[model samples]
Target: MKGVDLLDLKKIVVFLPGRLLPADCRETKFHVSATVGFIHIVAAHDYLGILDKLRVPDDVRLYFEYRELVLPQLREAGVVVEEPDIMVAFLSEMDLPEPGSIEKLRAFVQDVGGFDLSYIMRDLQSHIVNPERSTDYYRIMEEFARVPRSIWREFKRRLVVSLEASKAGTPRRPFRFAFPMTDCTFMVASMDPDWPVIGEDGIRMRTNAVELFTQAAKYDLKTRIGVGLLISKVGDHFLLDWCLIDEPWSANAKLEDLLSTPLFGPARERVVDSYHFRGDNAEPGT
Candidate 1:
């Protein structure tokens, strides 16, 4: 029988489970779509490729939502748009913590007020920099679900998965796809030949999709895409500093465009890109 062999380690895709997505997802600037919020969290943890390999399924009919603003810029020039999010599991490297031995995090948290999240994040990121404390920190996150059990259970789930995943140095967004955007006529794809039973393919799908969009820009596809950061507005301008997917592509000219649009403003709150980058204030556009 011509089937995916269990002996094939190179054929599986490592992916991030949707469960890792927080229930406290914030509102997107201008509410372009779910994608604005999606990009931010994925940008953190270097795209969190939990596994290493995958053989793409024969073909799958996929529906992707890109920043509408960029679609026109890429399509007008006939450039194919693709954003591949992979459910990866076999990374050769992983982001392991440096093993800080301070047992009490209260000291760390106390140094920077939790209420002053920006200060806490910038000064006390070490509190959750490792596997041991990462989940511990989040389970207790003030910003997490009001219910304690919800946060704790989810934290445990993520920790277990993180331990089992392939530890490759996960790459940040902005990679280019070996394949240009193509219309496969929307076919059925294997969840990715790697980790056939898991969500590795899902992670890979996102990674690939991101690459395709970035390439669209190199092709001189001019359009500004705004990845809705967890943080919203501060004063007259929202802190459009932190970039989730190194390259934010969209229909606007800059991040500021969202502010001028019907749905966004500098006074709104900023959303975090997952647990990555705790707090940030306004900065000149990147």
Candidate 2:
């Protein structure tokens, strides 16, 4: 840590995709996290309302500046070894497919305000072990299948607001995964599908991506969600760098629990403070 320059390490920011917890859970909150180099630097939004994209670059730029200012605090806390060279942010949102681009779109709606797949898996596991309910898999499957339709309906409702507003003399911008907030980007890097199988020697090895993709494709069920970083170079230049592309949903554990932690407000506050972000930054009808 003494000789390492924090600026030389990669800075990563993660904006977790918003999702609903199990029906039994009591809270619904959006989540985010950041890492400078290997350090889980101090910090940590249910941001469902509209965001002003015109103000985002400036706001994010200030966030980077504030983090730079606070680098020493993070270092003193021993969370970072060196100053991160690249600054990254991860963001995700529900997006409508581009006209005639259904194949390119991810069709599976994320679980929101309903039963999570995790819950379904648990139920399935219980049924598998309970002989009396082993044959009820189809019923469980049917119940699980309802989540996507629910998610899609919610998204479609949001979409209608955007469309209606646009028709009423207020044009809305398309969202981007990297920027405007989830689908406007032109390039989507492919995801790696290899699973990590623990070997006999106590090491984990990755499954082959090609094989995984091929298998999923056979069922027409191929989609990749990943941990990606939005890297910023000089002023106003940003790039989306995929770190763990095609990571399986099960591999994403921290994201699910992020909002449950105490660090959320402070983390977001530092960034918001940097830009003096106000709810009024959004234009009327935005």
Candidate 3:
């Protein structure tokens, strides 16, 4: 009989018993369950290799492969719509603060007399250079200016995500597949499996899945999709459900012509990729 050699051509190591210990052990780490929201998307065509990465379900895959055969009328329906940017010079009279620091933005907000920074900037650049400066507006600006820098930072991050859609080639609405307008499916997906809750206030707080997803996609291309609020249930506390849907079609006439779209299946998987490194919103473990 040959001698049994467990180490033949294999590296040996001690198995740590601690890892196998149950959560009930005093010495074992406490596992906190939390829910996270995720967006489910599948384009009519995945020229960008996104569909492969998403591992869309067999139904979605079949739809994409044979879309032309299945729905010939939609072949010429898609159009590249561009909103050209209008150029305008700012008024020389007003001093604009660079959005480099929160304090500077605050001061600028106070000077402008309101929280409508975009509107103020628009006025500065547009033909109509002033929008009736008033004390009431100034008071409102002051009130908003008093808010902490942390809140402002989050606002800035969201603003950046919103502006990214203005870039060239960004798709506009009704991200169509074979699905009809009424076939627009809404599914709840958990984006983060281990997101922490800041106690009772987590229920009241809302997370912007679009901003988060846009930031994750690095604005390489805009997602012609919408997101519902991240909702969490009490107890076990390990799930955040997000409403996911493609862009809505405004024309009521064509809704009847749409086909059924798959909203759920094995195509969904957890994306562990972090969004922190992409931009200035550098909070870790997000």
Tens digit of per-residue lDDT, candidate 3, span 95-192: 22122233221222111111123432232212110224333233223322333232233333333332332232232221111111223222222323
Candidate 1 local lDDT, 211-256, one digit each (tens): 3333342222222221111111222321111111223344544534
Q: For candidate 2, report its TM-score.
A: 0.17
Better by TM-score, candidate 3 or 2: 3
Best by TM-score: 3
Off by over 4 Å in 2: 1-37, 43-89, 92-111, 127-286
Q: CA lDDT, every prediction?
A: 0.24, 0.27, 0.26
How high is each candidate's TM-score?
0.15, 0.17, 0.18
**Better lDDT candidate (1, 3):** 3
Highest-lDDT candidate: 2
Total backbone clashes of candidate 2, pairs 3 or more residues apart or in separate chains:
13
lDDT per residue as tens, model 2, 29-90: 11124532332222122121111221233333333444455454444564432111112211
Write the number of the candidate with greater TM-score, choosing between 1 and 3: 3
